[model samples]
Target: MLRLGNPGRRISVGLIGMTFVLSIFAGRLIQLQGLDSKVYTAKAAEQRVRPEKLPARRGAITDADGHELALTLEAREIFIDPSVVSAAKRDQVATALAAELGVQKEPIMAKLAAGGRYQQVAAAVDPTVAQRIMDRDFKGVGSKHRYRRDYPGGDLAGTLLGFVGSDGTGLSGLESTYNKLLAGRDGEQFVETGLEGQRIPMTGGTLKAPVDGGSVRLTVNRDIQWAAQKAIADQVKAVGARTGSAIVMDVQTGHLLAMANAPELDLKNWQKAPPEDWVNRSVTDVFEPGSTNKVITAAAALESGAVRPESVFSVRDNIRCADQVLRDSHPHPMERLTFSGVVATSSNVGTILAAQKVGDEKLYGMLQRFGFGVKPGSGLPGEEAGLLPDWRNWSGSQRCTVAYGQGVSVTALQTASVYQTIANGGTRVTPRIVAGTTNGEGVFTPSAPGARTRVIGERTAKEIAGMLEAAVSTDGTGNLAAIDGYRVAGKTGTAMRYDTRCQGYCGYTSTFVGFAPADKPRLVVLAVVQDPQKGHYGGEIAAPVFKKVMTFALKSKKIPPTGTRPPAVRIRAGE
Candidate 1:
């Protein structure tokens, strides 16, 4: 430099050095102010505060008797912060977590080494295990408050209560239907963290508390439901059927006392069940009601002044309509059957003739009034409206077939409602599952009561119910449905399942729809066996099942017998 051999080189070197220094300063400023601001701010806040989550408690579900069917309890989701996990101790931490969570060690190690600051290793951990993990004082492992819906009754009301998903969402039954009311809001707080990545002792921001969901009280009688389920399951197993469903309703109040299904699954493990087992067939599936639909036909005839209980119809051996010839199960060559006998015998020819007399328009109108082809407005989720052909499109044989429940399709709930109308003295009432709502003060306020519409005169319902009683009498077709002390008015249905090869109907859907305590009816029950073994008949299969369920239901409700005993008569062999 002293010699100054190259003055130009010296000046250029000086300029380059100055530019490099300026660039370094600018880059540092940009990174510190822009790129790292969020991290720095979070670190600073972490040093001064600690925040927490406030989880809303899910509402409980109770039966009519105040028995807890479903409830929510505190649960925890175990999580970890890899940023706080010591590199030297990573293997130990992963191994411990994997062992505790019943998972493989390699997976846990991979998750921990993934380099994320926070991760959920496991959720819904057992309280004791969560406590152990918390006690370990590991900076990475922690837990948060969550809700786990528990059914103390287990599979008892699983089908009705439904199960919750991993995200705490309801997926079926009442849980799915009332999710909005059941799933309360979630609240969170902002907290400070320390240099070691531990939550600080102070809260930095405002606090917001979660609002709890309202409790739901249902009208389902737990005891009766238990009994009904047991009976239905037993019958389903005994009959070697694919599946079965039963519904017990309060005829007067339109309250569903009990809903039962066979091949029941535990709500906690609903995911493991078969697809068919999860279906609530009582309201979802529709089948040709077979002779059980004759009740509607008879009601229409009786209500429209088309026929009387004492009125007689000469049922021929066969009545041809269009390409089809309708015949009774048993051949009758122009027999004199009283209006009551027509139903008691479950004669297809007689029912068709009676429906013709009632006319298609009037019959269709009555069907609509009775809640057929339309949704029952039961508030149950995924309820099918069922299929009812319009009057204009109905074929000549279609009308007759529908009259005896061959062409038309209906759910068990729809069938039960028909009986419910008869039991309620011909007034149609909407059915309800929820009993009431709890107020802010925890006082239960009854829900808006169901509305009843007069479908037919009281005298008509009584007359029809009387004739129905004769159908289940000792000499009636549904003799197997008779309960010793209770007067049951019911009909048997055995329609073949639809098959393409048989030209139309093939397999059978056996069913029975009936009410008990005929004098002062208290309960209406509908039972159906989807596809049974060879001896598939409603009177043979479904009737006995109804008798069992009805007997239990009456005894459970303590419904006193209202009338003197009819002299004991032997049930006929063929009946």
Candidate 2:
């Protein structure tokens, strides 16, 4: 081994090396302890400080006439933090909470004794009950205010307005469709806390206030909605039909004034009701449109220049399409009739013959233009765009069958839209339900206005109006739909219902779709009753209801009568 001559110098150098390492470790400790506050502050905030959610108020739903349909109010929720209760007194707390909350004592005792740090027992208690529970002064029990939705209209527009869920979210109807606009942001608070997680004194917390949601204004007219609901309820109950739907739209604006369905539900308590009652059948359900679809065929023919109101055809003497023989309800063998006469009698044979002249291409184009087989874009959830088989997909005899409103399907709103098209001078507009919003200051911010798209020319629309008028005259087949002092134009539809039993058509659906004051129309009303007991004819079951509703609607609106008489048509020997 070699001996070092400078032992003192070597010792000093080693000591200096050790001192530098210790200084480096001390500097790192100071950096971690003092330089970064966000990390330590966040860690401290997470351990003892409990984050509390700031509740927000939901938006309101109003009618076009400024009537409140749904609103939200401040409500209280009672809860218990079981950790705060002493083990000896835990039984007492459980018993008191169970009786006050209407729950069994055993469950309450089990929950309190489970020893979870922050356990909530009962929630959503009304203020009276919440106050009573708080009066006990139980260490663990407490109450907090929350926003609860209320529907003042009750079942008036229940299905349309829809209901909200427990998480303060919109679940259905206008609520679900406009949920983003209805749900407000959640605000939170972080407070410095003590040993038992109790908020500390002199330590201020951070809070961000919640922003409430915007309001929704609907196109519904409350008075008209009430009247329509009453009439439909009375009729549906009288006839004993399974269920019914009534939809009224502004003929001029294409705005859905009222869309009502039965049986109605209360939005406040949706859990107690059957799931099926929550459906808005007016837009979601599809059925064979029946003769109510005749207007479509007639419009196609007139617009395509294939047939005229005066054009004549030989009504079936029995026209056969594959296995089905297309015939009028009351066959007048080899009956000669004009295009207008075909619709007046709702002659299936005549409509099909006219469809032959118009053909599939023109008919399909017309249906597409009129918004059939497609969603009305009303912004409601679960809206089914009724099935419309492509013209190319149509099989043997399919074209003819589709002519008289068969081999196709549509929703009530789609059927009504076709009539609203004619009533609005051939321009089709989107059907709307929500009107616009109004601030708490009573300043109304109307929804973006609807646009008009021209579907048929002015002359063709006028001729179509004249033909519809002729159908409802005292001498015509739809005379049951005629109203006194008003020239009403409408069609009655009796279509066979779809059956899954034999996997073929089984029952029938009675439908009436029409607009009033045919000369200068203002309102378009559509009512559908599924499977009436005895009388199934649309003319019998649906037309009179249509008249009753139209008469009341006109009188209610104070609309003056159209003094002009329907155009006269001369019958030829062959026609």
Candidate 3:
């Protein structure tokens, strides 16, 4: 084995082995430098560069005439890298940021003193203030560009406008409903960053430009909205109610001009409000429609040819419906009243008599046609399709009660739509809040009109309108809903509100629904006050609110009163 034989052969093999090893190394070098160089280079660069987000601007929500309800403004998200700042300079830097940003120094100091590479100092800071902090050029202090959602009206349409979160996402209300439309596509920018997530100055990388979101134009009118909100808020407070809602609808369009609620959410400080107050109660909360549903029963009777406006009924103070006894709103001697007068008086006994003529199926069918048991589709989030049990399943009392808007539930928006149907000549138009949307290029595209269905005949609607007009007459239950110099038409509702906590009827839901210039119907306004401590009657509580809001709306729109006299309807047989 130690023969040292073939020394020349061994030497050649050794050289060949060395060459093979070197060839392998050379091939690897070529692959790294030539074939996959871009891949490797990118990996190396990726370690050095970090991606930064470029937030897109959220869309503006405007009123009908282009008044801003909600809008986006440029802002800064100020953050800090504590490791970069020296201990001695921490307080000084924190002080400067706090002073310039108008924030308390203690919070900034607490954040700065913490041992970390990064921490948020403040959010939604003004750009100008952020710039001032940057001018100092303190180490570790940085500001990122972001959009801040601004509410110009504060709590004006707070419940309707909803609010945005710190992460720039819509959280509730219309914000949540049309979030995709309001939130635009975000973009990205790559910048050279150090190992500590700090952006290296002057080393620019690729950018993907952001696309800003489109704007939403609502059918809501600003002045009218303000008036409605004020009126409802005042009335709710005056009545000491748990909550209240008011709605104003365009008779011809079914467009919601103003939807107001009490105990409204403040868009500025939405977090401070109770979660229950966040919903749009106009379309969310449901209660027995009470006398407001009488119109539906009347329609059934007339449309089925079971009764006429002139048909008379001998109505007593109280009538028995199944095992339960139903009574008129007030006690009175038996009187001979025409069908119109029965409605004008809001007599449950009289209404039940009329419903008997229409029968259960016919009355239920009429209610369905008028949009009961269906959501109003007002484009507002949290809207409910109120409870309407099948007529066949109705109880003995419920059968009669449903005729006068009892043992059934309906939302304020739905109640208003009932009046809108009559006001619009028997056409039921789905309620809508949004008027149009504007694209990034500032081109506005109008929204398609709401779906319209004829729920009652024109003749039937006119007859109901006349009856409603009689309700606002001097002797009717809704007389207080009358407007000076204008023939007003409406109904009053005082329903026993079903409170879930009590598991029974607890308080009353006062409601007054009406349209002005009765013959020339322009607007339908509904006022509802729930669980009030002061008063419960619709005429006493809700009607005044309607008059106040309707008056403002009429003058606001310059809808002059039609000077024609209202035709007299016989309430008494002799008359």
Candidate 4:
């Protein structure tokens, strides 16, 4: 009954409603196309494009012989977008991936079940394994390019070469010292991608090329280093020593031929090695120089005109300095001995008496000039400056103890440099291990040789060399250090290992330092064995090590023996 009003009125009402609906649709179109177009377009583009990192390849490290110590190889990192994988296919996908990656299924399953958009399944996987997984074309699994460090030499020179971290950063040794030079700048790349995160072929993208790192060339001679390492390691084990170190250097140039340490770390698996095995003990550890330090006192005495090599001394087994008593390594009768004889025999009592004539200032000055109490400037990290109290702080006992290498400490490298100075004719040159660096462009930049400072007169150096020569002859304390067909000159030392807990001596550190072809010294080798249980004397434990290393070094350098006989000198208690 209510529908009877009119068809004309109904048609008018319909037209008005239609007009209002059209207007609303038109207004929304204008707002979307004009007012907010940029915001919507930017969001759409962001979803389509993703930026990825372009990793840079790290540099290589080589020895003087161009043998590879460390380098980087191409590796793959596998990732998964768990959100794209279905629960029904999860177990099958994880099994296949685990088989290809050589990993357990549990870890892969855990990552698949993480319920996240992205997860890393494996890192630093071999390229072949990654390729196998990619060949399968799994629903959510893929791999990206990466770099991993490789040490081909295993544990050889491991401490010196150091290792890299999981993030591809250098962690120690030369790797850490020159990290900036070795780690080049990383670049970037942008790629258009689909909704499922797969790269779209022919989609527009941008890229910035990466710069590869520069290579480092060291002065180490691998052959000589191998020989030295073998010699020291065998000797240390034979003597039942805690640890040992040996250094061979070119006397004239201060280039370290070889710096070998025992208890080395395996560079490939350094993470499993103890922290102590990764230390370069030659530069980091310090101990008293023992009788080997008497050379410094002799140089001081001769330079100060307090005594000559021919000067006579009335010696005794022990001498009193303040309340403390200083004694030689062994007891001897009262006798008259020349200065040269005292040094050849390593007479601690005679050295203290001679040191008294020069006093503390002159002796301390000589020690500083010899590169003790300071880092050798080898550019190695964590180098310690051994303890050398100022002469002004020297107590009566300190002065006498220091005269024969007590109350002071020095590193193995510093101890080697002392003899290198005399062998290089009294000029102390800074030791260098890195020969130079090479850039990506193949341009080499040589490292500057260390500055040489004259520590004593040339004549004084020769006189000391001659006295050292006598010490290695049949008559003296270092006779075991003599090499056939080579006039070797060196000093033997056995110092008490200072224990902080006891605040006194607990063990002995035996050392032998010397050079071969004495008159024209070319190589200076120093061997130090700490806490030897079987034998404690330097002549017994350390001297033979020195001889073995020096012999190999001399032969490796192809230096012909001087073939000259050692000069005649008297080393008896009375001369």
Candidate 5:
């Protein structure tokens, strides 16, 4: 050991060294406590405050009877924080997720290698499946709550009901029409978090509650709609037709009870089907009205007093009009038939003869009055207004053809509306499908009923109804449409289908529109089959389906027929 030269001098130097060291530490403490406090505090706050989305619950779609057609269910989105997952535990997590989630391990490995902080591994996972995965407690794995739309009825009212996209938006049909009413306002929330992005305990933050959407109730009857769908689908398949549609309307209210289309979209897996399946063809497709439109001519004639139900006409196989010689559907010898007989038999020559008296303007006026040449205002997606050239645009051939139910176009909806007017005793009602809506508070609001307008006199409508009833008799064309217990009134139609593929007419559009319990019509059902290969005549292919649907509607409503025999109408001059 070395001895100190001076004890007091040594002690003084040691004290100075110690004091200098203490001052350096004190200066650093002051800088940290005052100068940089705010910056550090703000950085900590930035890490603590977290913003999150609060998804609003979408509404439900129910039928007229409060049965669910579409609904939303709770789901989950499972993801992995690949960047935070330990390399040693990555394989274990991936293997666990693959086995538990039923996903391939290769994809999981790829996502891990991609090293994203928030990498989605699965979406729309069922709650049960998500719960199982969460119970594993794997590191860097998490799930967020989400919603998935479900169509409970499957394809029951598929195209008519439409579907929703993954982003919780309506894509087609009524879903698209009522999107705003169905998708309520979404909300946001702020929560405190830790540096590792963990939520803080006991920290209340700002929140905006979501407003759930309102529920929609449709006018469609589930049983009736299902029946119509089955009937039309069977007919289309039986006839080997390209497509078909069936519409059943409440005559008095014009409420569309059922709008059925063959080959409707698979609501849950709609993406796999063709886009054409998304269309409500009853409102979308338009074609020549065929003989079904002759009722408009008949209504015009009777309403104008140009012809009477008992008026006599000299019928022949063919008649000359303008530059064309129009003929009846079947070749026949010259025979005198009453006006009622002509309609009952669906004679083209007699219809043209009557049309000659009604002229173009009056006939066009009647057509318009019966809801032709315009959109039906049914609020369906892709509704076409249908082609109706102005009366002045009628060609020489079109002049005579228009008189009988050709050279003009109308949708199945328009044709149904025509029959609905006759069935509703001359008053034409606007067709509607939405019955009402329900708010989040559970208060119900009924949609306004369809508008009604008288299109013809009650006496003229009765006369036409008699003629339509005669058409369903044994001597008539639509005999197949007659139900055993009901005095049915209907018309058969076979028109040249204007094929878009060929840009011209190719196959036939077979149709039958009618109402049952004719004396007090409750329902008007229309069935249409397009481009049939097995059979083409409306009476053969379309009439039976009309009968099936009408019977079901009548039974569903408990509408017993009047049970009176149909009135006898003269079919020939000799009678």
Candidate 6:
């Protein structure tokens, strides 16, 4: 009897088991569709919505003449959806793309075999090359527009213009200083993507357009910059120096015309250049002003009423101060020299004696007034104020050494500003590199001129100008800085290069700072040569560079000659 009922019982048990399995499946379905539906829906939305980055166009950098120094060009990057490419056509596509892009077939094939939603095949492709690839219209392959920085002038103003990084960020120079103005705002777009990451046409969700960057117009003259660069490079090579720099400025407005450096970096491949080559030495490097600083000492003494242009001093080959002895570059007997004559001749002994009359506090104040120990307000990156210790910190010898431009240090730009002040009737003006900035709408806003500070009386500046004119005469050390048909007012500098290894002076740095048409100065130029192997004297190595650069600047600007020759000054003979 029990056997007879067993078949039906077994059937009932089988039905129950089947029902339990189906109930479990139904419960899971409800949990997925209702209980945790928001979580599942979020996952689906995440897969469909794709974010696209829209790059902003970088602004162009132009010289004063509107010549493009740095600009951007449209580029393309090729990508592939490997999963969407057919196995049979994969080899064909890889071979064709490799040939067109000049890339390795093996890598393309490997990417295709690996099978992914997205893979980069080529980057920074020329527009023409991208068009050719689009013509073929290979399945699963497409290109997106991108921006690439181009410097058409090669390295013409590399140090001043700086370079852009791979991510399109400004890395140095004006580019870095004005990065906010140059790197505009980036944009974003949201679109529905297919399974293979392809944006579906007509399915755009949201978009925010990019705002392009503003262009920067510099005060630098391209032609004058080229001339200054060429002259400095040639001089650096001729003198076998480590490096050289030259800067030309408008004496009245302090607008920089040219900031040139030797061994300039190629903007196209600046990554491979040495870090030192990337620096704008005219603003960053500091050295003693040597005789070039004599003008400052003379100005301080004259300003304090401690000395006059006609004041007399007994100058010797060497002079004792505290525990140290200061000597001239050459041997000479003790002689009486006018204060102006001492400055024009760059006599170290006489300058120290004159400085003693002014005292340390007054001298330091005068130096600060001339833009020393402070930034020149050029708005350049890494501009150094140079080192000038306080009067209270100065020892007896230190005071005299600073008077002769030994204990103090200065940048070439700062040195140029000193001469510029004298040329501007003792009024110091800030130096500026950028002339203006242009918005995307093409509206330009000119940069504000620097503030004017009176450093000396008008009469004192004229007297100093006369002395500077004498320095470029037939007898002074800076005679080589003379330019034909143009009255030159400048001073020469020869300072010992400090050696970090020995912690003392080792080599020489030759420098010259001047302005043209001494009567009515227009252009102020400063030239510096470092560690020259051929000649270490400023008159021999640096003055000629200043002359060449200044001559070109004067000519390029069409500055008419003053025609009046500078009056000859006397230096009393030794007994």
Top candidate, metric lDDT = 3
lDDT of 5: 0.89
Segments of candidate 6 deviating more than 4 angstroms:
1-42, 82-116, 121-123, 573-575
lDDT of 5 by residue, 11-120 (tens): 89999998999898888887877888888887777767767777788899988999999998999988887867888988899999898789899899889889866788
List TM-score per model, in order. 0.88, 0.86, 0.92, 0.95, 0.93, 0.90
lDDT, candidate 1, at 159: 73
Which residue ranges in model 3 land beyond 4 Å of their true spot? Answer: 1-47, 104-106, 194-202
Give the range of the ten consecutive residues with the poorest summed lDDT in model 2. 566-575
Please give, for residues 51-144, the per-residue lDDT of candidate 2 as tens digits.
6787767788888866788888877876656777788997788888788778888877787778766666765666787888878777767677
Candidate 1: tens digits of C-alpha lDDT, residues 8-127: 888899999988998999898888888998888877666566666777777778999889898888788888888888898889888788877788888778878887767888767777
Model 4, runs deviating above 4 Å: 1-26, 501-503, 573-575
CA deviation > 4 Å runs, candidate 2: 1-48, 86-110, 192-204, 331-333, 438-444, 567-575
* Cα lDDT of model 4 by residue, 483-502, tens digit: 88888899999899986767
lDDT of 6 by residue, 385-493 (tens): 9998998999878988899788898998999899999999999999989999999778999999888888898999999999989888887889999988989999999
Q: What lDDT does candidate 2 reach at residue 79?
A: 64
Candidates' C-alpha lDDT: 0.82, 0.81, 0.91, 0.90, 0.89, 0.89
Per-model C-alpha RMSD? 5.2, 7.3, 5.3, 2.1, 2.8, 3.7
Position 200, candidate 1: lDDT: 57
Assess candidate 1 and give its lDDT: 0.82
Q: Between candidates 3 and 6, name the one with more favorable lDDT.
A: 3
Candidate 3 has a TM-score of 0.92
lDDT of 5 at 371: 77
The stretch of ten residues in a row with the least summed lDDT in candidate 5 is 191-200
Q: Which 10 consecutive residues of model 4 have the lowest summed lDDT?
A: 566-575
